[model samples]
Target: MLKTLYKGFILSYLLITISCTTNQNSSDLIQAIDNRQTDKALRIIDQLDNLNEQDSLGLSPMHWAAKRALPQITKALIKKGCNLNITDVHGYTPLNYAIKADNAEIINLMLKNQAVVYKNGLSNLSDGPFVDWTEKGLYAYYLKHDSISSKSFLLGKFINQNTRYFKGWNGDTTTYTITDNKIPAWEFKTQEPIFVLGDIHGQYDRMVKNLQAHGVIDKHLKWSWGKGHLVFVGDIFDRGNKVTEALWLIYKLEQEADKTGGKVHMSFGNHELMVLNKDNRYIANDYKNLCNNLGLEYNTLFHSNSVLGEWLRSKNSMTKINDILFVHGGISQKQIDSGMSTQEINELVRQYLISGSSPKNQDKLNQILKSFGPFWYRGYFMDRSQYKKITEQELISILEALKVSRVVVGHTENDELSALYNGKVIDVNIPLAEDSIPNQALLIKYGKFFRLTEDGNKTLLN
Candidate 1:
């Protein structure tokens, strides 16, 4: 006992010595804030020469403090004249972090100090004057004398057969046309190049830039990849504050692609199911605040009446292009063994989406919406102890049953796009929205697979 105690004392003394001798830096300050060492972080903040200096992932002290909801550290950074509007590598400002945390005091503090909200098509204005697209049209909501109030100054209406215009009370006019939403084909045998994008998670600008760079969309952001197919394998919602913009872009692209010989497939993921089922745990605060300001539920924004909502309901949960099967999550051995066809899976999931209710405690609903479902399964990537990991032979039997060469999925994140299961499964979820890595997509050109980067460069994958 004495020997063990003496060893513990030496280890503690070494730790203290290391801590005392460590050099102070902005990165250290950010770490301190993340560790919740409030007093130490503050002292480091005061001693640091540059508060805006970012670490590897483009996070500074301001970003960390705001995200962690440390108001005192936030105030200290503001007092130090830190750039309030400084965006991280992922194009998120400190105010965006504050808004995500849902800290009203920090949000108000940033707004009062002239921090720019709504940068790059993302809404950061919460608990104050803000504008968002409602079911009717673009409306403005503001806090008035401790009570919330709103007025529809810009009322959008269908003015003509080919045009819809937004007319303000002051007669300010803007016009656009809505596209006819059509459900895409489930299976394709195209010889043309196929591009597969993983979960976007509402990073509109990043998605657009990646598409534009790859010549999928032109400078005007219209479909340019004629005769080629683009598949978004589920998850175009939640996180990153640009869900609205991302959804609209996909909507627009779907119609444009139909105009030519091209096709765009939108497969609904678990996040889509969550929102429709009133699961807002992973939802961004900006959206929550928008719903609060409008006095409506979050799911109501995407109800049948709304254009995006109606369009989303028509999406598939899985699609097949040639011998490749694209799904949001992996298919379990049991799911495949049940002899459920891809069409049946899509149909059942679509029905659940349309119902827009809790799927809890129901055996039929649980099969499609629960962990073993196509939208939630991750057995290919990791093993859940309750459910044994699928063996190589089980995977082979599953693929043979589906008649697919390989299955592509996006729910499980990886450091890079990876091929596993003896090249039978591919994981495209690289966590693009959270990391400062190269934007990549899986490109299949004439039966050859390649990792296509944002610069239109393709690296062949075996």
Candidate 2:
């Protein structure tokens, strides 16, 4: 009995030791991937006993590699015969993540490895692609050409409001319209009524209703505010599942408003810049699966080569209307010191997006992309260890430099549209597109500012 007990204890100890070592190596591999140490992750994977070991997020090394679009690391993992079809905690396979990244090389690698697209019986396509588009419901077929371009032929079937429809590419550039990709003037001195809203995190339905109620759009969701200006202070990406729909709505409104002698301005926000830069941390799961079905990445949909992508590039980073400066984030004193005009700032941002910043302009680009930059600075609300408070004198100097009386900003979330610094700075970033309930926005008309709600009620503010 004593000898048997000794053997049992020895076996248990060995198993526990092996388990601990495997867990440690697995953790190290994940950390390497997160830190973007591709070579180190590859090395760890080679030494790892179980390549499918998951981290707390239930994503294995393969999933992370594919999600981050690290083609070399993905190839290394494939060579090691890692399980390609392993699903993460989100019920997404490695191939799904690769598709989300829109990484063609990695996606092709996974497909060649026989990564499963369906789990049990339903195709991942059944989950849908756009806001109100689903394969199962519409019997939608994947087009040979992914984008709606003049050169590519589009063929697909869809159902809207229970009406079955088929759309065939006519090879006409007019059929699939690409907006005139020209940057518009950012400075305006208009007396027409202005409606300004904050970050719209992909809540398309809520945004349409909010605009409709405020008399910006008519019943058909077309721009009806003739000669009036509608400004969206950045952030029409990520979070909600209807980002694509919201973007299309804005795109349509922009064109219609232009025809009616009105203007629709979408300033670049932090999320917009982040998405354009290929940062997909905050993207919704719906988008991941949708992109998987589309055989593209999220950024690819808005890349310089695509239609909406070009339109987005044409947008400004900041706009000034009648002494009121509208920016996604408030300006800092450092930005004031930079002395970049509104047009220069827009031009620089556009250049950076197109080809990245030149080495000579690296220092200036750093300041622009920093937390204290135009689309990110929140010093007007409060200061932190990283962001110091902008004093009243500093604010005056910034406004005077920009030749604006007040600055209106979004990004700092507030319960309602409020004023700070004795009404010098106004925040319109209420809970708008993040939820289903109606939210308020800032309205500037008749030389007075007011808070406009979805019910068309306007309350004067300073």
What's the TM-score of every candidate structure? 0.65, 0.67
Best-performing candidate as measured by lDDT: 2
Q: Which pairs clash inside model 2?
A: 102-297
The sequence of per-residue lDDT tens digits that candidate 1 reaches over residues 250-348 is: 776877888898999889888998887777778777766555532345675566645667678888889999999999988897787667789987877
Which lDDT tens digits does candidate 2 get at residues 359-379?
Answer: 888888898889879988989
Q: Give per-residue lDDT, candidate 2, residue 14.
A: 97
TM-score of 2: 0.67
Question: Judged by lDDT against the true structure, how good is candidate 1?
Answer: 0.74
Worst lDDT window (10 residues) for model 2? 145-154
Residue 277, model 1, lDDT: 74
lDDT of 2 at 393: 84
Q: Each prediction's Cα lDDT score?
A: 0.74, 0.76
Kindly state the number of residue pairs that clash in model 1. 0
